[model samples]
Target: MQIQDLPYPDPGVPDVRSGPRFLWWLGRNQLGGQLTSLAWGLLHFMAVSAQPFCVGFAIEAVIDRSGARLALAGGLMALFGAATALGDTFLHRTAVTNWITAAARVQQLLARKASQLGSALSRRVAAGEVVAVSTGDVEKIGWFVEGVSRFSAAALTVVFVCVGLVVYQPALGIVVALGVPVVAFAALPLLPRATRRADVQREKAGRATELASDTVAGLRVLRGIGGEELFLDRYRRASQEVRQAAVSSARMWSLISAIQVLLPGLLLIAVVFYGVHLAREGRISVGELVTVYSSVMVLMYPLRHFEEIAMAYSFSRPSAKRAARVLSLERATDAAGSRAADLPSGDLYDPATGLLAPAARLTAVVCGDPDAAGRLAERLGGHPSEDGPSVLLGGVPLDELPLEGARTAVLVQDKDPVLLSGSLRDLLDVPASGEVGPTEALAAAQCADVLDALVQGSLDAGSPMDAHITERGRSLSGGQRQRLALARSLFTDPEVLVLDEPTSAVDSHTEARIAEGLREIRTGRTTILFTSSPLLLDRADRVVLVHDGVAVAVGVHRELLHTEPRYRAVVTRETEEETARGGVLKELHALGDAERLGDNERQEIEESA
Candidate 1:
């Protein structure tokens, strides 16, 4: 496909059997573009090859003192020169297009795989590896793809030139023809070494990239904990390893390059020496001798493509293998293990946790451990854990439903939801049911202040909705970002919404309002909330106390608070801390009041104090 028609309507299913197989699949998909590039490449190389022949003709005409032949020779030279220019220009343009298009196609496939895998992708693949594949590896792969056609064209031109020389003058032609292959294949022995070194470099580079990514992602936390230097030192070591690997790889390629240069020069020397001998013996004319020399000189340019092909393959093979490895990953049941099932309308039940939230009701789960809460929330949304039967909706396993069907039926918002960079309006725009509007969702999630902040941050914006958000909503406070994310999820209006600590970042006043709004908005839908906040639990229709990993008790918030000591301790820790702080403040105030009192009055109240 052409660049203009890029971002393929469907990137098509990738064949991830191996690196070579994946490369072949990419080539097969873009046969049209490859062929077009090949045609232009052939034209360019052929025109260039004809220049030596034309020069030979002009030399012959000059020697014969023939005006007609001279004029004809000059005309042919001019014609071929123009053809050469035209072909070279178009060939470059087509080659670049092929490169970009192939990269775009691979990017599309990676993106599609990421979407299909969802949160599972991050679990299966390293963030740095994905970043490396998407950024550098993609270009390397595209480079090899574009090089193929050019190399083919160059090889073909060498073949045609060899035949022409042999037909014109066999004595000199045979020597040059035999010498060309030597120059072309002389570097083969070093290619395997170069390729192995390149693989080492790529692997080291990928690890360095991963280290850098991890360091940057947690830079804030590292600084807070005074560990920034520790991470920096670690990253420095990784960077050094990468540099060493790269140098080793470069050395091998340099050796290959030397071979390419050395063999061609030796071939040129051999041809010149043999051609002069043939001319002295009167076996060939002076013009034919010049033709032979010039032909060898022109052949040098095309022969360089051989080395380029080797270098390109060496670099791209590892990149393709990494890409293929990532693409080959599949969710536990997303492969052929599961069949599409109809979306079910019933209670959401996690067999692992033995937690069931009945349909059309707001159920709250009180889990003291945040990690366990997160896992349960994921399960409720049909994302299975490593060692558990998939969550079931009604009686059918959620994993059995088609991916899109499951997503439409259940939405899970983890504690830390990401806010992608975009305008406020675009941020809220998602593939969602039309039941809820952005305004209603924002209001329900208590994001009025967030909207005001957005508008105030960008005064020239058309409206508050037009204000742009920074990546991950870094411009907003933790609570503000959480509310906006909640608003977005609320706008989706899924049939069953599973939230983990949705209001944890906000103050109790805001959290209380959000809990009320949440209950109101999800009047007839199934909503499961995993939190220990009394403000939210008090608003649930029913509360489930999950004590280790399983639901231990089921009751209303107040009932659990009085009857379940474990539940009360888990939910009342913040309240107890606040009460203790209040007591300390009261005693401090009493001491200050007594200090202000007269000595006699202080002594009268001293015993009570």
Candidate 2:
């Protein structure tokens, strides 16, 4: 494939059984590119080998005092020079194209896997490992692939050169051929040691990278807690470990490089010494001696390729293993189950927990165990999580429907929703068929204060959606980020909206407004909220109390508070079952005024704003 035609239409499924197997699979996929590179490489090396032969012939012709032979040799030499130039240029072009194409294909496969696995990807592989594989590992893999053709051609060129020397003078040729192999394979013994060092270096580097990533992500929190120096020290130790490992690996490789250079240099001396001794004995012509010497010197170029190929394999082998591991990650799913028809329009019922939210009704679920409440939220949204019978939507098993189909109808917002870094418009972009305008959705989620804060210091008034939010909304207050997540989720306008403690970060005033806004916007759709707040719970059409893995009671907030002790205990974390935020909204204006008065603490100013 051409370099311009990168990202192959289909980067066929990788053979992930082993690193070597995966490497083989990569080579097999780009057979056309590999062959094209190979052909050009062979031509280049052939021309390189012919150069020594031509030089030798020209020397002999000059000695014979034959004008015709000199003219012929000069013409052949010129032709070889032209061939060498063309071969060298095209060989480099093809090798680079192969490298780019191969790297592009692997990148595409990785990107596809990342999208398919989503958040689960981090659970399977470390973030640093993924980064290493995509960057350094991919480059190493491509380096190996790009070098294969050149290595093969160089090896073949060495063989042809040896054969030509042998044909010219048998005695010297035999010694030259035998000594070439010795120089070529001398570094083999050091390779194993070098490869081991490389592996250690890679592992240490990966740990260091992971440490740095984690440290950067939590830098703000660390500084707040006065523990920044602690993490900095840890990172320094990790960095030193990586440095030591790298130095150790470099020492072994340096030894191998020295041997590669030393062996060839000694062999060249032997060829020259043996050729001189034979010339004095009249065993071979002086011209023949020169020819044999030139041939062996040329053979050094190919021998170096042998060393390069060894290093390439040593590095790419482990890289291939890492890449294969990432490609092998498959999401927990059933093919046959996913082929079933989509859920039509009806209630969401979880048979495993016996919790049901009727169609077009706002149902609030309160479970004492937060873990159980989280899992229940997953079920309500038809997330094919681990264990239990499938949750049904519109009389169809949720797990049986395609993932995309299930997500289309049910939208779940976890308590800790992530606000991705981008402009406000980009943050709200998601996969949903229903069209809810940004203004309408923001109004429903009571996010007016957030917009005001975002546009506070900015000049752009024409569109607040264009305003930038820092990575994970680090620049924004926690409460403001939470409101933004809720607004983005509300904009999806799905058939069912499942929210888990979505307004926990907001103040009572904003929470009350959100409660009313949510009820009004979700007037004709199913909304399942897994919360324990009495204010939010009081607004639900029906509150389901999940106790000990079962739905124990279903009723209004006040009715259940008076009727069921367990329901009251679950909803109210306090044993007394008091509304902690009761009458809190009466001080809404006061709270805002206090924050406005203390400009220094503006960072903690708003939950909704």
Candidate 3:
């Protein structure tokens, strides 16, 4: 397919069982592009081979002083040169198109999988590994794909030249043809070593990349905890390991390259020597001998195709494997059947945790282990459950519902939410049947400061809503980004809102305001909150204490605090911080208004918030 055709109308289901199979699938899809590239490549190589034959004929004609023959030979040479130029130009264009199209297809596949996986994406794959797969891995796969036609044409050219030489001078031709295989196979033994090293380098590089991404993502936290140097040192060591592996890989490839060059040069020398012997014996005409020698020399250039194809496969194999792994990741389940077309309205129930959010009520879930809380929150949102009871909405299996349908019925804002790079308005853009406007969602999420910070960060802007946000809102402060993420989720206004520690990064005062706003905004809607914050818990219609991985207690927030020791312990700790937070928050307000807080200054309040 051509670039003009653009993102494939349908990327089609991929054959992701194995790397080579995936590569074969890509080639199959781009057959038109590959065939066109192959045809052009053949013409280019044919013209290249014709040049040596023309030169041999021209030399013979000059010796005979045949004017007509000389003229014809010179004309043929010019014609071939023109044909070579045309063929080379088109060959490059078609090859490039094939590369771009193939990469685009892989990109589409990755994107589709990523969207299907949603919040579970980071859980399945490292952020760095995903980045590497999408960027470097994709490019390598494309490079190999584009090289396929060129390599095929080159190999065919070598065969054709060898056959022509055999017809022109059989004895010398046989030797040259046999030597071609020796030159091509000489590097085979070294390839295994080189490929292994390459795999090592790629693995090390992926780790380093993942480490760097984690370091950058948590730079704010590291600085807060005075662990910048610690992380920096770790990254330095990782990067050194990556560098060392790369050097080892390069050394092996260099050896292979040396062998490739050395063996081909020896073949050239052997052919020339043998041709001279033939000339002396008068076994072949001088013209034919010249043609044979030149053909072998030309053959050397095309024979390198074998070496190139091997190297391309070596590098691309791992890349395709990574891409395949990404593509093959099945969503929690095949998009459950029978989507809730018009937002299924009912109580949200999790049979595994035995946690239930009655319709039109705000239920708080308190988990001692935050990790457990996150998992439970995901399950509440109908994120794949391979075994055990499925989350049910309106008595239907939430896991059995289509992805879009489940998303419409229940929306979960994770503990750590990301804001994609775009304008403020664009960031909040979501499919919500709710009547809540941007202003309402922003107010409910307590995002006034977030809007102010984004407005100041934007280059060209009107209202704060029109301001642009950087990728993942990195330019924004922790609290600002958190509030913005909340605002985006609130705007969606789904039937059931599952918020896992949504206000963990904001201050106590801000969190209080958010709790108040959320209660008002979500009136008569099922809202499931997973957090340990007392201020948020105080507002829940009912609270469920999750201890040792199961729901052990369910009651009002105050009753649980007065009764359950485990619940009281977690809640009281936040209570102490909340008291101190009041004074600090007042001082913060005295310095300036909330609007004065830039996105960068909004620190994450604390971990256990």
Candidate 4:
């Protein structure tokens, strides 16, 4: 099945209902396995109960002095032993199958939800919390779910054993039967405390995981600024908190375990004492007293199941809650009947900022605040947000389109694009299609040098572009990754492309080439370039200077530089500052060849009829 086809209902707002409902949903999905497990558990418990009866019968037969009776009792005991062993084995097998299947289903559901949400998933929930749910929480919930059948069978066995004893030897049987339930249930009071501790432990663990992930992702930057030690110190403190929380949780569980053992022992003692009193009074025979004791001993096994189920539930409840919280994140909603097909394909506009880009125009947006630009880029790409005016494409609201459709129609290439691990070819093969050839896309993004570098560093015995890239393209330089990202977007050939500072990482020459190539390749497509580079802005058909969330000026790049002092100052910071120790013109000229041979080759190609 495809990843999108996996079953994952939109879990609504979390309440007390969410955890129980999720469990119930899982049980319903695996009802057949659950029933099979329950049947086997009952059969297993019955076989176990019969062992005690066989032992008591053998004792009575020995007293009667009948060889035939003794032989029959011995045969019955051996038969019950084999039956009990087989039953227990099958029961455990069936129960474990149920546990694994249930966990797998929950994991599948969680994975599907994560994929559906895409980048939005981490925004709504901590990365660590999502990690914990998929890993630990799924197993805990499955354990509790499977334990239900075993505990039910155990409870039923205790009832039947009690009734049998009451019929055979009423006096001692009543106390033995009544005491089991009390001892098993006595641990309930501690469960709430245990669950609370478990929740706290899980919370702290998620925080520690988030810290670790963040530290690892920013490790290079941290080390570059000599802040690695500071982050390490913070992580160490967080790890200690997680350890303390885990210890606290473990202590509560230990207390519960002690009670599970102690209370059951107390009940066994009470049963033995009562059974002896009845035998002395001649209310029950010696063999029957043996039966009474054996039955109580057998009852201990089932009673243990009760305590185990309690513990399992205590641990799983909070885990289930955490899983539910992630599943419950709301997806962006569109108006009824407003499907992706209805979305228009002309100029994109943002009403909040009053910024309009005519169709097929190369528009440059200049914003003083980078954060505002980022937010605007998101909105322009149809990302859901509460604080912005709606973005429209050809007068149709962009938010009304389906996610996939909107993404295909309008691609947003962020400044720092995420690079997934794969071969160079695989890395550039996002949203996989064959519209843009590899060589052409590379040339368009001015990535020939980047490709050559990758080839030089290839460790595999294969074509360089086919060489495997590490996770997040960590093996490649930052500028190479960025250019590769630009190449990928250029390959997509989206009708409307929004690039946010796409050339921020590259050198001036490479940046200028990229800007020229981008304009040439996307000659007829509507492209929005968000950058402060004069080289890029100079090529744009129109440059819009945004101040305080509104577009204040719209004109050509050179016109804005001459007329709009704000736009000019924003772009040419070094040039405007008189106090700045500007480099000598001769020194600037030595930086690079002003008219490189590569530029001449590109210009010749452009002019070729």
Name the top TM-score candidate.
3
Across 1-609, the per-residue lDDT of candidate 4 in tens digits comes to 112333435322223258877777777766776777788888888888877777788888888877888888789888877877887897898788778777776787677676545555665687778888888888999899889889988888888888888887788778876877777788788888988888888788888888997888777778779999999999999999989999998998888788878877887788778778877888777888888888877887888898788878878888888887787764453422266474478998988888898889899999878878887777787765765556888887776777666777788888778888878877766673466677778899988877777777776627768877778877777788889999989888888999999988899999889888999888888999899989899999999999898899999999988667678668877344421222222233466643454766544533441
Q: For each candidate, give its TM-score against the true structure.
A: 0.85, 0.85, 0.91, 0.85
Compared with the true structure, what per-residue lDDT tens digits does model 1 show for residues 221-329? 6877999999989989989998999999898888888888888888888888988888899988899989989998999999999999899999999999999999998
Error of 4 at 99 (Å): 3.2
Q: Cα lDDT of model 1 overall? A: 0.87
lDDT tens digits, residue span 497-598, model 2 = 899898888899889999999999888989999989998999999999999989989999999986676776666654441332222322544567543445
Candidate 3 has a TM-score of 0.91
RMSD of 1: 8.2
In model 3, the runs with Cα more than 4 Å from the true position are 336-342, 458-460, 573-609
What is the Cα-based TM-score of model 2? 0.85
Q: Better model by TM-score, 1 or 3?
A: 3
lDDT by candidate, in order shown: 0.87, 0.82, 0.85, 0.78
Judge candidate 4 at residue 171 and give its lDDT. Answer: 82
Tens-digit lDDT string for candidate 3 (420-486): 8889888877798668898999999888877778778886899888899888888888888888888
Please list all clashing residue pairs in model 2, or write none if there are none: 449-609, 450-609
RMSD of 4: 9.5
What is the Cα-based lDDT of residue 583 in candidate 4?
26
